[model samples]
Target: MADPQEPRMTAKRFHARPGVEDWRVLFWGAHAFYAADSLTHAVALASAVAEIADGLDHHPDLDVRPHGVTIRTRTRRGGGLGPLDAELARRVQEFARGEGYRPDPSTLMVTGIAVAQDRDADVRPFWAAIMGYEPLDDADAVDPQRRNPHVWVHELTPPKPGRGRTHIDLSVPADHAKARVEAALAAGGRLVSASPEGWTIASPDNHGVDIAIWPDFEDFGEDG
Candidate 1:
């Protein structure tokens, strides 16, 4: 229980003002996230959000919860869902993605996934010897038709440390982290965590991916 002097946290709701359904304003409703299970959790969360917002120039309507905070950031001038709102959503999403949160599919779609092959040198050497594909300028080789056909490889900075293998990272809308986890589980993916950072899911083959749910692209400051 919170101390008597502690600030009380309550549930709150935010809705668009009537007749403000324009795409710029109404594209998204209020956003929500669960805070950590402690009083200091709210303070830390608010501080982090304030820093990020200060950097972005965009502001959000926030509700403080004992465990987490819910933020609704949409451009009233835009009316419903505008560039600013989307950019904020993406920025938040990227932050959450880095933290391993998974989004719900009902709430979002997997925009992209990157497979980082840390052992490019070793892997490339073996593949180049076994296959006849010509080596590329970057030292990473690929068969245009046989490979992902969509994925592009790039150099790793400083090289990967001991024994790191490939890893999969998934992206989704920021608000759908929970829903995405449920969907992936329903589709034969296994749930790994229910922590505040987000959820994790893995396929039957032991192939695991992080479903990072973030806001749409327009929310970031540069998107302007």
Candidate 2:
């Protein structure tokens, strides 16, 4: 048996699992996100997952909705992903596949608003109060109900010109980054820039939106 105190599995190792390539598993730091179709399918899958988790004494955070279900797995004991999470993900993938619940990467997308300001402290509270979101330790705010996108205030030295101080940040699985960018491009959006983290897309009117992989170290917030 592996040591219970073993360090969390690295993102590279987690992505290297045997059948993971065939599943729609997305690596986000210590956690992995999986999406299922339909509430009924999600409920059924959750039931099976619950049983298996009970047997293994490992549980994932589950959000079941009318359109889809989101599964997030991490090892709290290890403070990140580990062999246990990998094993459970494999089992979930197999079961979900057998049940005809296809993996949908688009369902894993999360949105957040980014505001560039000279002083984040000046505007953070106002946005938080208006949105009814609680402040995270890093000074970012998230919807109290976890239903709305997060609002992140990033400090800029002199700030930029134009109506571009604020932008939308769309967090997607790394594997789906290219496809999402392409889709946006095809829809009249233009690519402003690209990086390993993700792409910056701009609307015809000049508004910017970032399509990025979930940051390995930043906790964007939980899903509803």
Candidate 3:
């Protein structure tokens, strides 16, 4: 049996579990989306998920759209997944099935910006000023409302211009990354690189985007 005192569940362990097909780890949390046929259906589904979170005393971030309800769970205290989160996910899946909500896994994604700048330079302040994002650390910042992509400041010596170092990072599930890469390829995008984590692709005009396995880095310490 797993120890109750275990504070965090790594991404590997979380993904190895069964019956969690509806959930995918993204950024700092595990996310699941359920599609509803109508706005009324979405609200009711959200309410059901709310009850599951409340019962577990481990609430997840909930977004109720016109067509679906997105729920994200994590261990805010330990900065990663907790057992309660898995429990919440299981319950949500159970309720979703009973309620006829369709689990939509392909839509799960986390997007961010990767800025490669001079090692001695600090660009976070400038990005924070313009994007209205709050600095999360010496090299990163995020939107206060969580409405925008996160900004990660990666230091590069000499900071060569147009080396494809600065680009958008689209993090998705391992299974989903392949499809994203394939779709990009079919759309005339050129592959810049590839790895087990994901791939970097360039648009026709040379704009680059990195599609990667999400929660690439952990311990975001995000409570909101």
Candidate 4:
């Protein structure tokens, strides 16, 4: 039997597990993206996942689509990924594999807009009002219906003088980050920077965007 008091799994540890290494497990949290064949197939998979989650007393964020389903699991109470998430991911993948649905990290992408401001209070409301987004917190606003990407305000000291104060943040599965970066580079996007967390690619017009591999956990800042 597993010890109930065991420490939660860290991002590094989670990626080292067999079978899971192939999945798009984020370094900041635990998540898995699976692709289905059709809407009917997605619904069926979600139903199965719900049953398993109910049995385990653990639930995951499920986004069902006409041809794909994304699963994100985290320890809400603990504020990060835990052993429960790992177990749930394993079970979910097992079921997905059995159903002939392979893990497709390329299909899952999260977009966010970042604004650099000297004071968050100075500019948050304007963007929030214009975008019709609700305050996720003091620093960020999100679409009430979850249909649009998030908008984040970052406090920068002595704000840089330039018109390009905003940039797009793209979160992709860790396994596919390099491929995505390469594709962007091939398409005239220049590499601004690179790190284990992700890469910053600039468009032909000099607009910057980050290709992140980590899961977008609220309140953890861009690093998450």
Candidate 5:
């Protein structure tokens, strides 16, 4: 039996471990999506995953759609991937393989919005209340159902106009960051800055669009 409580595993370490190729570490957790031919097959895969999770005494969020099932696992006691998640994922993959459900890791992504504000306390409530979302913290709000993008109250040292009042966050696995930046550059988007945290890009229309790399490591280094 897998240990219910274990040492925390960083995202970089999780990827380095063998047998988790089907998974991708994103903003809040690790996710895997199985593309089934039909909804019936999708349900079967999810059901098998549920059994694996139950046996391990660890549960994951499963999203069942007509085409496929999206599964996300995060440590309940803490954040990010734990050893338990890796075991559960591998067991689920074993069952999925027999059922012929293959995962498309490239399809996994996490997105959010950043609202620049000098008065974060004043503006945060409006977005949280208006969106009917719950506060993840004092400075950020997220959809309770996890269906919508996370909203962050970004602080601007000195507020100014004709500058970015808000920005769109596009978060993906570390391996995908450079390709995404290249694609954006090809699309006429101008480069703003690049760092281990990720890339800050400006759209042709001058809107801020950030390509974020979570579990920041020099995995592939930042794009030029």
Candidate 6:
């Protein structure tokens, strides 16, 4: 028998137990992302995952693809979902969400990604200005933080002029929306559209990365 003072190797020592798996959360089970146009693009994406893993100190099983890739994570210690496993799941989900990967509730259908490209040399500042997204340095980039997800800015491959929106509408509190918009604009973002409801901000290149501000329900003049 081991001494009482000695650490005992127990089932609890494992990260996730067989019977413990959370289905409600998006990242609990195996998750995969679809879409990669080229081999180089695929490699870049894989590097991004590697970057995330090194940051978390918990590696994931990756299925790289020229058109897509899958990320599957399991807790070796617990052999199921535990505290650390949950955290890893959260990180993966956050990464997916930040990158605008929509998640489906039914079949864990979280796939598809939006691609935004900037040809200008000063693109980072432009995007940071418009999105109000905190810029992460190289150090923070490798180590995945819970708040902001990583955004990779690859070379244009071949620069070309395009005229189209590469953005989406971001609706927030009307009152706060103005401030958010202003803050984003001040950060180097450009204004594309605006109204009482909200405004759309975009990148310098007119990419569709836009935000919409909405009046709060209370401010919507509803009698409550």
**Model 5: residue 129 alpha-carbon error in angstroms:** 0.4
Local error of candidate 6 at residue 224 (angstroms): 49
* Residue 17, model 1, lDDT: 28
| C-alpha lDDT score of every prediction, in listed order | 0.45, 0.67, 0.77, 0.72, 0.77, 0.43
TM values, all candidates? 0.32, 0.72, 0.86, 0.77, 0.84, 0.31
Tens digit per residue, CA lDDT, model 2, 14-43: 677775543333332223334555677668
- Top lDDT prediction, candidate number: 3
Name the better of 1 and 4 by lDDT.
4
Clashing pairs in 5: none
Alpha-carbon deviation at 198 in model 5, angstroms:
2.0
Each prediction's RMSD over C-alphas, in Å, is 18.1, 5.5, 4.3, 4.9, 4.8, 20.2
Give the CA lDDT, 0 to 100, for residue 182 in model 3: 89
List where candidate 1 sits over 4 angstroms from the true fold: 1-108, 119-168, 194-197, 215-224
Query: 1-224 in candidate 4: lDDT tens per residue?
Result: 23445555566666665656435544224656677788998999999999989988988778889878887776633225667777787888888888888677677677789988764236778899999988764578877665568888887656554432789998777766788899889999999899777899999999999987755322232122
Give the TM-score (vs. native) of candidate 5. 0.84
Per-residue C-alpha lDDT of model 6 across residues 1-224, encoded as one tens digit per residue: 11324332222232133322222212112334535666676666667767777887777666665665556554422112234444555565565556644333222222111234446543555555554544444211111222233333343436654521133434332334556677878978888767665566776666544443321221222111
Give per-residue CA lDDT, model 3, range 88-171, as digits (tens). Answer: 888889889887889988898878899888756677788889999888746678887766788888877666654436789887
Residue 139 C-alpha lDDT in model 4: 73
Q: Is candidate 5 or candidate 6 better by lDDT?
A: 5
Model 2 residue 139 CA deviation in Å? 3.8
Residue 161 error, candidate 4, Å: 7.7
Candidates, ranked, lDDT: 3, 5, 4, 2, 1, 6
Q: Highest TM-score: which candidate?
A: 3
Candidate 5's residue-wise lDDT over 1-224, tens digit each? Answer: 22345445677776777777888877667788899888888888888898899899999889998789998887732235677878877887777777788888667778888998763235778899999988875567988877788888877768664454778988777777898889999999999999878999998999989887765332432111
